[model samples]
Target: MLRIHFTDADLARTRIASAPDPLWEICASLHRMQSRQGRWAYADWYRGTRARLHDTGMVRTLRTLLLPLVPRAAYFPDFLTPPEAVDGLEAGVEAVLATGKERVRAEIGILHRTSGAPAWAPRLADPELRQDLVHALRRYHALAIAPHHDRVQARIDAERAARARAVLDGGTEALLAGLGPDLRWQHPVLHTRYPEDRDLYLNGRGLLLVPSYFCWGNPVTFGDTELDPVLIYSLRHEPHPSALPGDLGSGAPLAALLGRTRAAVLRTAATGATTGEIARAVGVSASSASQHAGALREAGLLVSRRHAAFVLHTLTPLGAALLRANAPCAEPR
Candidate 1:
């Protein structure tokens, strides 16, 4: 088990990352490719990713470089998933490049001791070698991650909306408590499943809760406490979720009944999704999603309200009943 001790200030400061962290996703996605655990959840992504990697001739780079460095194990170097990744991939690669040589050596040494590293792993401290690794990461992301970014963003956006609701309905504690079945919030300490026993003290810096599309089974944190305290945990995935009604082909009867994207917009709003969330989830432009939502609101299928800069949409009774009649039985948890 891993325990995260938080102060009041930590609670005040604690928040979810507004956007996906690319480097962390890279690490998680690598683990997904390496392990069969929870493979069913990522069946589509797995198939697509494998084909992309093969077509791009990234097989050697993935095997000889990426997998060895980011083995699906208890420990991998923290520098690979730097906090700067929250900004974007390029910023993250820059952070990885900027890692101090001493820190890189120390982290690589830890990786080797905890979960065997390649013989060349120690040489990561060399700036030139780090550039090579960065290249591999970028290539892997392009092949595996960038293509599926919309789905990833939609899933993460849904999770963020749910968490945001939890915070508004209760407080920050509610957000933590409802993180997932794998995590438990016991007042000042948040406990999560881990391969080892450890404690993280977030004296006041708080914690960055990163909901990852690829992280599976457990929450991951930095090996070094001195780093920014962020917890990367698996986001719940429902195959063909209501939020992603667009996955059903455009010619499907449901699309014909409600006009494809409009129907997706409605389903996404079932959980009070924002206009932006609806746009991403249904693979439509924000203007399109807004127009669909406006039409639905006028038709009495959705209720919309302005909250801060976001307009939140929730399903009306008629809309819920319509969905219930058309929706399949809920997926088993």
Candidate 2:
């Protein structure tokens, strides 16, 4: 059992990640590859990833190097999963490379003690070795994750949207209490059924709740309590079989009501596109795309924020909900 003690300050500071953490997904998927646990939810993904790795000629290298780093037990190196990875893959890799040599050595030593580290694991302290690891991670993601990125993103977005609604309907306590079956929220203490017994006092640093599409079974936290506090938990639902990229406009009634152009614009925003990019993607005039985006924003389906001179558009909770409700029955090609 893992007991997490929280304070009023910690409760106020608690928040959910806006998107999936690439590193956590990578680690979780690697663990899935090692065992048949949660096979019911991930059998298709597992088979597909294995075939992809074999076709891309990455099976042997990954098996020898990366697999050892992410064993199916306690003490995988924390440096491999940086807290800053919520931004994206490149940022996450940069964080991995920027890990202090001493920290890297210490984390590697822990892995060695808990689950024997590969001989080459010690060399991670070297900058070149770190870069190689990053390269391997990127390659694996490209081959294994990129193809299903949209499906994963859609599932995560839906879960976060529901959680957000919970917050609005019942405040922080409701949000915490509804986290999942594995977690039990009781006043200031959040109990989790962990592999081992442990306790974490928030100390007002708060916690970041990250939703992962691949993380299986119980929720996971950093082994080293001193690290930034986070709980990466599995999504409540598996990726819907029909949830595919670019299928947002397939809903006949929605497309008819909004027209193909505007509906396409809303779907494009689901993946976070700028106005100009949306224009190019939907083959519309920049001014026309901007107008459509404005209308969607007004309808509470899209939210646009200015980043420098460009206005980036992303789906709101209502928007994501609408998209999921209208997703096509057939998978994308």
Candidate 3:
């Protein structure tokens, strides 16, 4: 069990990541490829990414370079996922490149000790070798992570909406309490099932809750305590093939959402709304609002998630784009 001890100051400082971290998603998706644990949830992505890698002849790079470094294990270098990743992938890769050679060597050594690393792992300290690693990371991300950006962002947005509602209704503590079944919040300590036994003392720095689309099984945190505190966790999987990002033009056309109620439903979900909230905003009954939301969701325009006592609805990337074309005015009713 991993126990994260928090303080009063920690509660005041705790917050959710405003957006998904690309580097963490890269790491998590690599783990997904290594294990079949949650394969059913990502079956489409799994098959597609594999085929893309093979077609691009990046299969050797994934097997030889990427997997060794990011093995679905208890430890991988924390430097690979820096705080700079919050900015974007380029910034994160630059951070990885700029990591001190000595520190890189040390972390690689740790990886060898914890989980067997490649024989050449320590050579990553060489700047030339590091560049090769960075290049492969970029290629893998393009083939795997980039194509699914919309679905990943949609899932993260849904999670943010749910957590934001929790924070407003209860408090930061409530936000922590509802971080999926993998996490347990009991007073000042948050517990989780982990590969190893350990405890993390927040010590007033608080924690950043990063919702990752690919993270599976148990929640993950940096093995190094010196870095800023963060918990990268997976969201509840809802396999909506129509909603999953990929394939060209698999969705209904925007003209299909020309109906007044469905367009209103899409617009109201711009900032996320419950069924009742959507109904009230669009001047319709709850069941009517639900049916419209369902229609929009099927049209790949809205993503809904259940939080506490309500099902919150938010716009998917496709949904948002279509709403701009169909409902130029912000006011729903």
- Which scores higher on TM-score, 1 or 2? 1
lDDT of 3 by residue, 1-333 (tens): 999999999999998898889889989999998898888889889998999999999999999998999998889999899999899999999999999999998999999999988999898899899899889989988999999887788778888889989999999999999999999999989999999999999999999999998999899999998789999988898754453543327445545677777877787899899999999999999998998888777676788888878999998887776656655566768
lDDT of 1 by residue, 111-229 (tens): 88988989998899999999999999999999888877766775666677778987998799989988888999999999999999999999999999999989999999998999889
Tens digits of per-residue lDDT, candidate 2, 199-289, equal: 9999999999999989888888999999889999887553433223344544543433368888899889877787899999999999999
Q: C-alpha displacement of 75 in model 3, angstroms? A: 0.8
Among the numbered candidates, top TM-score falls to 3
lDDT of 2 at 107: 89
Better of 2 and 3 by lDDT: 3
Query: Poorest 10 consecutive residues of model 3 by lDDT?
Result: 239-248
Top lDDT hit: 3
Check candidate 2 and list the clashing pairs: none
Question: Compared to the true structure, candidate 2 yields what TM-score?
Answer: 0.75
TM-score of 1: 0.79
Q: List the residue pairs that clash in candidate 3.
A: none
* Minimal lDDT window, size 10, model 1: 240-249
RMSD of each: 10.2, 10.7, 3.0
User: Which scores better on TM-score, 1 or 3?
Assistant: 3
Cα TM-score per model: 0.79, 0.75, 0.94
